[model samples]
Target: MAGLRRGRRPDEQPPEVRMTTLPTGAELLRYVVLVTGVIIAPGADLALVLTSAVRGGRQGGLATTMGIVSGVFVWAALAGAGLAGVLVASATGYLMLRLAGAAYLLFLGIKFLAQSRSVAPPVDRTGGAGKARSFWSYFRRGWVADVMNPKMAVFYLAVLSNFLHPGDFLPGKVFFLALVHASIGLLWFSSISLAVGRSNILARNPRVRRMLNLAGGAVLVLLSIEVALPMQW
Candidate 1:
């Protein structure tokens, strides 16, 4: 019954007071949209996608994007699967979770901003046929690349607070949130891919690729700043 620290936002009381009054589906929808929009906008994920585009070329960038989305899918899946307890009430618990989630995201963003790129592989006539990496290696790259990305965690936690309804079906809601988040990622990445398809503007210049990486790093730093700075509500 005691208020959790996370719920103790700048001024908002623990969820116990507000969640007792469940938000309407419309309100919930709005929250979901806000979360999705935030994810879609320029941030760590976008930056990383750019990095992939520059370093790995279009196909490699796309692979990295898929991996990024996949990571989000996993996080959402887990949140949805375990929603019964978190979303279903216990104001203290919800707030606590919120704070932890927020903190985690901020941590991820800062972490990524500080990360270094992996060593470049030697080019080959077949473009790595002789040295093709295994599926797991690619998978790992995608997963870790996105996972190490702190911006994603910040985005997930930040957006989640919007749609979460206390004392409701946790898995069901979190799953839906996941869908919204993942869908946005799909759209954003797809657009980048189209630009990548041009292959002329970005692909022609080696400098362009380096610039993209630098920009990506900058975006992530901003996302981290957004996450790390004090949050409202």
Candidate 2:
């Protein structure tokens, strides 16, 4: 009777509490370094920035960078909401997006190839006629190129998934990460644009411009193929 009185009933047990862990400063630093390397790596994003810089000058390149950064935030928000994971998990969704991205990249590559054959000036020759229009054009191009890239979604799903904790405030952390990535991109692309824009040789040489267009176009097509291929992950 005394032992029975001392024992607690099953219904009287305490509820289990889940603990959330935030990323440590060291972890954050590591993430920043990793992200910076990725941003600076040779990819569609960097190629787009270089092309824009060569064609539209510093203002155009910066505008394009802004657009690309905006796309990053959009991706981060989607990832934070768990939408990116859903897309990645669903075979149909992943396939659809992958195909779309591949098609877009192919189109861009073809356009570049066509431009290489043209006799137009290396830079936009519209001058004051459609300055505002040109800026918006480059901005839209950047935004579309970044947004249509399924690789970004995969990156967030695969890479950030490891860095972020399920119990943590996901949206806040993702936004912070996105902002940091964008800041790095802006800094790097801005410098490239300034340097490219100041180069009279690149701006004046039609042959070099043609070669760049051909190279960029080829790289995009290759990237598209890479995207279209099935991954084991």
User: What TM-score, computed on C-alpha atoms, does each candidate reach?
Assistant: 0.56, 0.83
Query: What pairs collide in candidate 2?
Result: none
Q: Which stretches of candidate 2 lie over 4 Å from their true place?
A: 1-22, 122-129, 230-233
By lDDT, who's the top model here? 2
Q: What lDDT score is found at residue 152 in candidate 1? A: 49
Rate residue 54 of model 2 by lDDT: 61
Candidate 1 wrongly placed segments (more than 4 Å): 1-28, 81-139, 148-169, 217-233
2-99 per-residue lDDT for model 1 (tens digits): 46654555776555532233447787678666766776676556665665555555655566677777887766664455442344345565454444
Compared with the true structure, the alpha-carbon lDDT of candidate 2 equals 0.80
Q: What is the C-alpha RMSD of each candidate to the true structure, in Å?
A: 12.1, 4.0
Residue 181 C-alpha lDDT in model 1: 66
